[model samples]
Structures are given as structure tokens and as C-alpha cells.
Target: MDSDTFVYTTYIRTTPEELWKALTDPGLTRRYWGVAFETDWSPGAPMVWEEGGRRTADPGQVVLAAEPGRLLSYTWHTFTPAWADAVGLGHEVYEGLAAEPRSRVDFAIEPSGDTVRLTVTHGGLAPDGTIKELIGEGWPAIVSSLKSLLETGEELPEPPR
Candidate 1:
């Protein structure tokens, strides 16, 4: 609700159930998000982030809320050395991000005239926060890729090296 919060919305030509699946299903998520989560979708359950054959999660990263096909909220990820190495981020920068207060992301899904509106609100971001900026930079591409994958049955081309 504040400037520290980042909200992204995209309308996918799909059902709310499908959009929810894309947000919660590990396999589906990995296809578009480049990351998969391990969680039971319970409010208090832990959400582990796995990607590129590396897994990283911490106590601070857990499901804040879950309602299938309607809403899902979870604490943001933990930055680890393996994650930094895999993502090409410097370890020091990773540490700096890790030191910041953990943020949370909430996904709200709604039916909208043959399409589903998916809104992602990422909050707890401090002004000029490193992790905030990182997530803000990342969400647009992530959301667009998700839309493409759901609509076209295929993901967009990989970024150039």
C-alpha cells in the first residue's frame, strides 16, 4: 500500500485455477519462474526455493497465507552462496540483500471475462532497498513469461548470454 510496496498485475487468458497452479505448483512454476518451491500450501508451512540444482530456504521464508485459486502469500527468498553463484550475483551483494528485512509477496487471483487477473503484491520493501530493487527489476519479466507460458503453451526464449 506504500511506496515501499511493489505491485504487479497481469491478465492471463486462463482460469483462476490455472493461474493459481502456475503460482503454487512447483513444476509449473519452474517452467516460467526459473524457480520451484517445496511447500504444502499451509499458512505456517515452510516454502523452500530450489533452482538450478541448488536449494535454499530459511526460517524467515514461509507461507503467510494460502487459499487455492484465490490467494497465496509467502515470505520472500533467502539468498545463499549457491544462489548467488548460480544467478551471477556477487556474494557480497547477496550478503547485503540477505541482511535486509525479509519481504513478502502476495498473489491474488480473480476471474475476469474469460481471463484471470493475477495481482502480485510484494511488500515490506524498504526505500531504496537492494532486494526491493532486485525484485522490482525481476517481476516484470517473470510476469510476462508467465503470461506467455500460460497463453501459448510455451515459454519465451531464454535471455541472451
Candidate 2:
């Protein structure tokens, strides 16, 4: 895998619809992943994330054209005033939501036995060391938390041991 891309797969003892809602619903995502997704979930809709003092997906952000379920694509980051005024080509330490450019999130759900396997692929990130490393480390914890939430109906106090 390229340093810019990180792939994570998790098996949850749940149905596809359950997994889909868990992945798509912003409320559910916030509980498990600690990020809030804001979008109408329609094709050509802007999916934005508001965290800290910065808000992603402003001017020049990609708009989702169609969002049925399981797949979400949005212009992740555009040249914000802060980013544009920054000295370097990039300002954010990481990419995706901020920092470097290029961002998209693809989530797929498949059936396995009585459980659903969720595969999350985040790509289009700037090919940088920090972005790659952070995604690699962050994905596992998020995936594990999702798995625990689905199985036990509660967030795990700690990442899977």
C-alpha cells in the first residue's frame, strides 16, 4: 500500500443495513470515531467535517453526486484562507480533512457468515509521511471501535487488546 493510502477491514456481527447505518449516519460515526460528518447524503451534496476551529469542504470542495449507501465521496479539502496564506504548499500537518490535498472515503460492506465485514479505504491523500503514518495508526483503532460497538452495543473503553 502506498503511504498515501490506508485500508482497514473489520468484521462486525451484524447485518449490512446495520453496518451501513453505522458507517453512514453522522451521529453513529461521532460515537465511535470522534468525528462528525455533515451532509444531506445525496449525489452532489457537500460532505463537510467541522472540528476544532477549522471547517473542511468549503470553497472548491467536491460535491457528492449520488449517495445511496456504503459509498461516500466528497471534495475533502480546498484552498481555505489559512491554507492559501500558509508559506508552504501545504499547511495542515496531515492530509484528508486538512493539510495536504486529495481526499475521498470509500466504505464497503460484505456478508461473512452471520456477520458483516466492513472495509474502509481512505485514499487521495497527499503522499506524505505524517499523513500516511497517522492514517495507518488511526484506522485500526477506529475499525476496532466500530466492531466492538456493533457487537456489544457499546464503545470499548480501550482499543482491542
Candidate 3:
């Protein structure tokens, strides 16, 4: 990953409007994300989620926000309860990347007239072998599952052990 940016892109066989709803609507996201993404479409609004009793909401503000078909960008930190108080894995990681000291998450959507191209960029990941390995292999599966849900309205099977 020479890019220093972890990104995943997929072209869904659906309109931007449909995918927008799938991304922003908590009810619809649950159909694909398997958990509700609690957020209101307002700049600086907080976004968060809980799955299987685990909270995954990074503490930050919604920096870039556009409607329907453009982009959603936000500041993020890996601050789940599991990471709390864990040295060498908290704000230091975020600070090491840049001065902003927060992870950047981007959801960019491009309209192809017949489909929506979705790109997810998750920056500020720990530059470690295990973490990179997991994310590299896992994101594609998740994106493929997102495609399956958007196209066929079916959730992907549970992740393997």
C-alpha cells in the first residue's frame, strides 16, 4: 500500500439516490451494514453505530457533507471502549499521521448515469502487519456484501471464523 491511503471502490448497479439512501438511511444501512448508523445529515453532526453490543463510533465531527450523490467526509478516531486507555494505540496513532490528529473517512459517490460508483477511504490505520492485513482482506468482502445488498436486497452471510 504505497498510497498511504486505504481505499475501497465498488460500482453498484443502482442509482446514486438508491445508494444514498442505503448509505444515509439508518434503516436501510442496517439491511446492508447489519447495524444502524446513527447520524443526521447536517454538518458537524455526530455519527455513530453499535453492533453486537460493540460501539464503533469514532469521536469526531462531520467535516464534509453533501446531499444525495456527492461526498461524505468526517474526522474519526479509533476510540472504542476496547481501545480506551490502551497505550500505543490511542491519540498517539492519530497524532503520528498528521497535525489534525484524527482519522479521515471519505465516502465519495460518483454517478455513472446507470450506476453509482462508491469509494471508501479509511485513513489513519495503525501501520502494523496484522491490522493492515486484516483490513486489506476484509474491506473487499464487506464492499462485495454491500453490493449484494444494494443490487439484490440480500445481506451477505455472516463473516467466517
Best by lDDT: 1
The per-prediction tally of clashing pairs is: 0, 7, 0
Q: How many residue pairs in model 2 have overlapping backbones?
A: 7
lDDT of 1 by residue, 1-161 (tens): 23789999989999988888888888888888888999899999998888988888788889999999999999998878788888888878888887888889999998999999899999988768787788877898889989999999987765763
lDDT by residue (25-48, candidate 3, tens digit) is 777666665656667777777777
Model 2 C-alpha lDDT per residue in residues 44-67, reported as the tens digit of each score:
666676543355666455445434
Which residue window of length 10 is worst by lDDT in model 3?
79-88
TM-score of each: 0.94, 0.72, 0.73
Off by over 4 Å in 2: 1-3, 52-57, 60-70, 75-99, 158-161
Question: What lDDT does candidate 3 reach at residue 27?
Answer: 76
Better of 2 and 3 by TM-score: 3
Question: Roughly what TM-score does model 2 have, to 2 decimal places?
Answer: 0.72
User: Which rank order by lDDT, best down to worst?
Assistant: 1, 3, 2
The candidate scoring highest on TM-score is 1
Listed per candidate, the RMSD to the true structure in angstroms reads 1.7, 5.2, 4.8
